[model samples]
Target: MAITSANQLELLQTAEAVAREKMIDPGLVVEAMEESLARAAKSRYGAEMDIRVSIDRKTGRATFTRVRTVVEEDELENYQAEMTVEQAKQYLSEPKVGDVYTEEVPPVELGRIAAQSAKQVILQKVREAERDRQYEEFKDRAGTIINAVVKREEYGNLIVDVGAGEAILRRNDKIGRESYRPGDRIRCYIKDVRREVRGPQIFLSRTAPEFMSALFKMEVPEIYEGIIEIKAVARDPGSRAKIAVISYDNSIDPVGACVGMRGSRVQAVVNELQGEKIDIIPWNEDLPTFLVNALQPAEVTKVVLDEDAERIEVVVPEEQLSLAIGRRGQNVRLASQLTRLDIDIMTEEEESKRRQAEFEERTKLFMDTLDLDEFFAQLLVAEGFTNLEEVAYVDQDELLVIDGVDEDTAGELQARARDHLEALNKAALDRARELGAEESLISFPGLSPQMIEALAKDGVKTLEDFATCADWELAGGWTTMNGERVKDDGILEPFDMSLEEAQNLVMTARVALGWVDPDELARAEAEAAEGDAAAQEAEA
Candidate 1:
């Protein structure tokens, strides 16, 4: 390609056209063209030679030059890429190291192959620029709805023609029972914009909960204006969905606004989802009240919340059990997701039976372990003392408040509880010793007799084994034999150690066994001292 002045103008015009068509900056197109021309020039000038090209932005004038840097004789690694100060004097008056020189060269005639290579280079550059532009445009637009046309389908995934780019709607992200054909207009949530080697892949989703929330935001002006807020959403996808909304303005009902006039707003969303049933319920701060609303259309007779377990036991009338549970437990499952709590739906009869069983179990435990009569065990169980731990920990004053339990009786009961625990600990220690537990592990600070026995049972019988134990392993992060993690139901076995206590025990064992360097121990002591000083200062 000869760069005549007229042809130079054509080159600039071509760049401008391609930039406008590709939605990229014209300067980027010019840079690509320059790079392509430089690549072509290298073929004529020899690949080892330093060649550079530039095109004037205003004048459209093209220039090609060979670049060389002046260097000491010893520094001239490549003769074509560098020139010695002695050789530099041939081209310039001053000869110095670290100086650059440029010599203009006449433009070369392009061979057919060279021209094609240059064309490929410019196309690749322009394609890269376009991908980057699309990525920048859509990356921040994730979680928002975008309208597109179905351009084609591949492997059950739709290629959507979003303006200036193409997006992918995977089969799994499509609403159940929804179908699309080529050129079909569709709206999808922009799930992600990923930049890959091929191009930016914009993923779209129709069944995402965020998609439903966004639809409501579009339909409800109050939500858009922040007068109403969507607290949570749970979906069975295409079949049914529930959304909890709260209102900031006292006069505005959030659910009513989301439902719109005679359910027009929600119906629009439902139509878009192919008739998915939607339940719009008002959000409540009280968990029990919120659970009742979540289990809507089902009457809840009572709710027993186990806060530590993050579970709720909902007792319903016999007739409402199936309704509360829904078909195949869908109602309670969605309610759990919406409220972020596990919901156990039960009939009143089941709850009554469970309560009675629990009462009997606690009574038997007290009667057997505390050596109490059946009546006394029942009395303690009735007073809400579920376990010996509670009996041992409760204040004497609180125990005295129980019916028929004077201060002397409360004291005697606590002593007996302590005695039982001590006997159990002594037995555990004996068992641990029999299992080859080291005296060092038994005497380790922060290790209780029960912990020692647990460790011995698990084959962690030595001081080194105790030192090597991770805090989570020593505390409560173990998965059960059934492959389930020890959850809030309770800590298991050796994992019953508190994190702080476990750390202390591990560090003490490590130091006692010489597993840690003395310098590290000193540093740890200094850090602990500093931490304690800072804490004392904060308290002050």
Candidate 2:
């Protein structure tokens, strides 16, 4: 209706200036303002009228354009409509059927409604533009560390001012033993960034596994140069962590390099993690050995591995079990994560028991075929001779050197030992007959009658017969005669006494069992009597 005051013109320029500052498309701002003006115009001044608003950048003034659709003569209530083409053609040269004309509407008709609508539209456009800008700036920073200032702490979460905007550092992501005050300079890992209604929201973390890796890269020069690679890292946050490092150059010690001078490098990393203990261990190509090292501070005696199963059984002393497993199983748990292997730790006692059981099984097999005393059996055991070949390999001097043995005695022991050893390979029943063992030997205390019976039936009839039995098949079972008895007792002990007291018994049984061959016992006795007579004759 009239020229507006300076304030009205300033409002138009303010919108333009904000649009420029935000780098929004100029057309978008114009569209927003026009929509706002139209809403206000329709509500304030009746819907019958048309309204258009424009801002003159050069003149800084407001202008409006109002138009009406061309309709037929009967459309009298169409306050925003004009005459049809046929009527307009009488006053003008070229008028189409639907031709409409425009006229300027006064600004007074817009009133307060248009102003409010215009303001809302401009604000909406600005917010959308800001969100787009923030997204573009932050999306590329994922997985990288960013330096920021601590704005403040809200409910134990750090609100970091990462230049572009505030990023959230959740309580769990905050290092356990570290604190930062407002305006403190800090570093955080960019876990994620997402565009939200307010702006680009960033998620930052201080306790991430990658954070430890990044710290190592900064502290260890070898890591930065790529000579040593961190294969994997597992952390217990504030308390402890395990890092598996490998050297591409074998000459360079991966563990030593990561540890640095007196652990200065790792210590630095630990300090940064707020005193979390860090273990820098060499990563082994062999998973079993690698896992052994991973569960450190615990000494491993043996590593039994199941390659196809991807499992490792590590045996350690009972004293080291707690250390290897760590408090609350932290050490082994971290090792599992680092090596990706299922790890089992056993104590020395366990492995020892297993080995002892195995040794007993072999001894039982040898004892199954021959009747022998415990002392004689143990003498063979003391020589580390578990089987016949071991016995055959021993020399006379070696046999004599066995405790409680002399040269002549060693000779006898060797002869009897070999006789017993060779008989294990005989057919089971023949072996039993050779050793003078019967179904009765199986029924003795501490002897497995069923096992002895099985051995006898299998043609392993004597202690020697049992020795050659496969260790797998030599397992002793319970019997009604003797519960959980050893197979060795049933097979090896046929004589009632020692070599001294049992000489006559040995002689007799050897004859009865066919062990001395036909009448050789009597012939040996006669030969001994003759030798004694000749010695007496010589003395006279």
Q: What TM-score would every model get versus the actual structure?
A: 0.86, 0.54
- The CA lDDT at 263 in model 2 is 82
TM-score (C-alpha, index-matched) for candidate 1: 0.86
Name the best candidate (by lDDT).
1
- lDDT values of the candidates? 0.88, 0.70
Q: Which runs of model 1 end up more than 4 angstroms from their true locations?
A: 370-373, 389-419, 439-448, 462-540
lDDT of 1 by residue, 272-372 (tens): 99999998989999999999999998989999896644678999999998899998888888898898787788888998899999999999999999898
Error of model 2, residue 530, in angstroms? 89
In candidate 2, what are the lDDT values of residues 1-540, reduced to their tens digit?
A: 223765566656766787778766665666666667665666666677766677675564666677665666676456554667566776557876567677777665444655666678878877777677667878998878889999989999999888756799999998777899998998888999998767788999988889899888888888899999999998888898899899999799998988888888888887777889888888888877788788787898998886533467889999999998888989988887788666888899998898788667656644653345666666667567666555555777777767777887766655665676546434443544554565534432333333344556556654444334332233322223342223233222331212233244334434444556656666887999999999999999
Give the distance in Å from residue 54's predicted Cα in candidate 2 to where it truly belongs.
Answer: 6.6
